[model samples]
Target chain A: MSNKYRDKKTGITRREILKVLGVSALSYGFLGASSKVYSKSTAHIVIVGGGIGGATAAKYLRLLNADVKITIVEPKSQYIFCPGSNEVIPGWITLEDLMVTYTTLKTHYRINVIQDKAQSINFDKKQLKLEGGDTLTYHKLIVSPGPTHHYEGIEGFNKELAEGAFPSAYSAGKQTMNLRNQILSMKKGGTIIISSPEDPYRCPPAPYERASYIATMLKDNNPTAKLLILDSKDDFIFSNNYLVYWEKHFGYGKADSMIEWVSKKKGGNVVKLDASIRAVITSNGDIHKGDVINIIPPEKAASFALQNNLAEGDWCPVDFFDFSSLLHDDVYVVGDSIEGDPMPKTGYIASNQARVVVQAINDELHGREVGSPFIINDCVAMAGQDYGMALAETFRYAGKGKKLGERYHILGAEKNKGKQIVRQQVAENWQRTFRKDVFE
Target chain B: MNKYLLRLFFILSSIGFSNSALADDDLTGGLSLKENFELAKKFPMPSPWLLSAQCSACHGTLGTAFNEIIPPLAGMDKQEFIKKMQEYKTADASNFIVMGIIAQPITDEEIEAMAGFFAKLKPEPLNQEKIPRDVVVPEWAVMNKESE
Candidate 1:
């Protein structure tokens, strides 16, 4: 009773003071916790192009950060992979097999799919302009627009010729299908000429792969048809390996063989193509007549990239970490459109870059530092049925230099019968797994 | 009357302090969500000049031209370039020797710089004069169709 009277005369009790302090501390903690939770739930990332790079990026971004809002803008309704396109030329696979849609990507990964081409990007405004007159505001933009064929350099070769006489099935679409149809319909003894272009084109091994597939087709279907490869360079990067495979599969080196590779050293470099006459004039003043001519002319950035002012000289420059555009910081460029040393313009590389970009964006969104990134790529070219050769390497960035980590070669020649079977299995598994990784 | 007024004022101040403390606790609990969301929305943009300086060494000043060895960067495919550089780092199949070497030392950040440099470059016609037309294609034999 005495204590109570004294406390009443005094101001407050110890328990009450503690209760007030606890409530204040708890309120501050809750506020900090809620902000963190809300921040992680609302990250928006926009990717341009629906190719391997962009699609992979969209998928992986979701995987890395499930809370992210991912939007992919592309012109095409479906994506046709260029990786396994050689099989199409030989009629081993159809165009339907190569086609993939964003619907599957969207349904499986919760990605937003927009079927429209990006016309321009306002870096300062952090907005992207679409050809449909719509603008999208994004926190980060990843551009993966592919290449454009240069048809002006070659004399008498343009879009019309590409549709009819000379088809550069570089871009995987109707043009690819048309080229396949043309090759299949050629006469038994008709001459087929495949021309290689100057450097900085898509798929370094593609031309050779195309030649191999065509030669295989000719050998099996039309033994009398001759396939001529007129190369622009003296020697290609994988010349030895490709030639070895050619010799083993096609009766290469024999005069009666179906395939003939004409390198620049052999004076068979083509300077001009007379599409009307179906003749290819070489630099040595020689004329070669062909029933089918596949001329891969010079290439530059895609038309949309140039029109949008995203191009520097011939290519788009971007930041390596997030694949953001250098000219326009808000927009990030991936795949073949941006410049990267040591990395080839291959689908696998694009996919790898996509993963890196997605990771960086997610980390940035989370207010976390991006860890060291490791990018790896491998290119496997099918020489014949059940026969494949591959090249692989890994890279890391070191200030101004790109440090090489490891390089590997996978060939089917060194293995025993049992091992060969395993290697084949590995190759098949790789294709299936890779397809799922990118498309599924 | 003065004593009664003082007591009233004291009671009101105590009540006001308690309410503010409750409100602050509520705000603190929800702080991270709003702040983090804002940070995610505000991504840092890279400097264009930094990217250009790096690209000029290989792609030439403003991506004009270095030599026939290196293709002009102007009007190049942004996706293709990025993809190619990634290949070089990972050993994806490519023809250029320098790309693999150049990409070896690059970071995703540096790749971004290079991409940014080319993205800003103006499109130009390829100077094809230096392109060697005399390079030979090895396997073709001058065949007379009439004789065959």
Candidate 2:
């Protein structure tokens, strides 16, 4: 109500300066020199997908910063782990053993678990729209929606065919169980065909492990059955190690062995599939019939990420330190959806990435200087009932000024008899411990 | 009046002298040029042979521990040890909480030295000859249900 005049040196009113000084003095007295006041009331972090990566991020973020509000939007109420699902086909572990619910995350961790799929994201506005017509506003969003199957490559391979004829069983749910049941119900002397896609896919060693487990089961129950692996690539990451284990345990090199591997370089690439005939046509114009056909198609980022304009080419690109999207500032992608040069898309790698992203969010909220961040991964592949191999790597990020350093392969191995026993026991322990660490 | 002026001068000089000493102390402790160089050299420096003796306290005479919870470092991969040390420095990941704490203060050079020393160590059989043959299984293996 008092008259105010602008200063000659600057356009700001003298009263405005006085008011600002008063507010600054009060703030300084209350919070001290180091503290900061952010524009938002509280940092709201929303994580999509309830897989290992997403769940780990949600749990760690809540633990690190209790003040930050965390909400997890996952379409599924329960998750069946894909890591140990290979054992299901061999009857080593049941489907029920791999099932995990979000009760632990909701009750013990106090993370708001919502049963909704994130339909769309408005990055500019920092808002996410759910399929249920509800809108959620978040200060930061972590999207680890996992990988979606690429169905366009094969002629007669689609969702319906994958379910009924040859199930990919890649996403780890009912399809995985269905595929397991089909394998169990097959004839004793039946021929099983498993197709492996090229590189840049989920779980590089998984297809080989599946073949190994299936061979183990066949040898035990139906010794006359033959399992053939048709690989798109000539040399696989763990082919040599798996081959050694298979030869030692299942007599893989013998003429009447249960398992056989055919590389594309050796003329085994399946060009087209006839689901009704239960046969696949090779690129060299040869048709091979099988009692059961399992085609693991190529993969891309989850459908939600692609549809929401969060992907660059096939995968999402993120800043290695915070895992924030390069395309969108507010959106952060982790797990198999993001393109990490050296890190493989495995469960352990995703969980490690989640921890890094959670720390970055905490640092941003607390106004603390971020440290030099590092991401590490370990991939374990079980080739037979007892034999397995492991690969581990670590990636370090220099600060903002310098480029990130090269990734280092920390550990790698080939399976042996002594190591096999240790690996088998460790695999069971890892499945239980890792699931509890992330979900519980 | 002259005495009071002299006293004020002495007090002022003492204050100036203490301030300069504080500045020097800060330079030595914090991220100054000298400190950075010292850290760089200390971090990647190799450990002496005596350092292996220090590890023998809890890890046994060689690198084998009393139980499986303490993994045998003998024959462990060199690069894996380095990466694991770095992970411990970040205070992330599980399965090695104590190792992480022990490794927190160790430099990269020390890690390399330890890894080299341990890699060369021959795997010694546990001192189970004195114990009864029926009690051969380690306690951890039994608890984990991994006993043969």
The candidate that wins on lDDT is 2
Q: Give per-residue CA lDDT, model 1, range A375-401, as digits (tens).
A: 556565656555554544444443323
DockQ of all candidates, in order?
Answer: 0.01, 0.02
Show model 2 residue runs off by greater than 4 Å: A1-41, A398-416, B1-148
Q: For model 2 chain B, where is the 10-residue window of minimal lDDT?
A: B20-29
Candidate 1 chain A TM-score vs. reference chain A: 0.85
Name the docking class for model 1.
incorrect
Q: TM-score for each prediction?
A: 0.66, 0.70
Q: Which numbered prediction scores highest in DockQ against the true structure?
A: 2
What lDDT score goes with residue A397 in model 1?
A: 44
lDDT of each: 0.62, 0.65
Off by over 4 Å in 1: A1-40, A401-425, B1-148
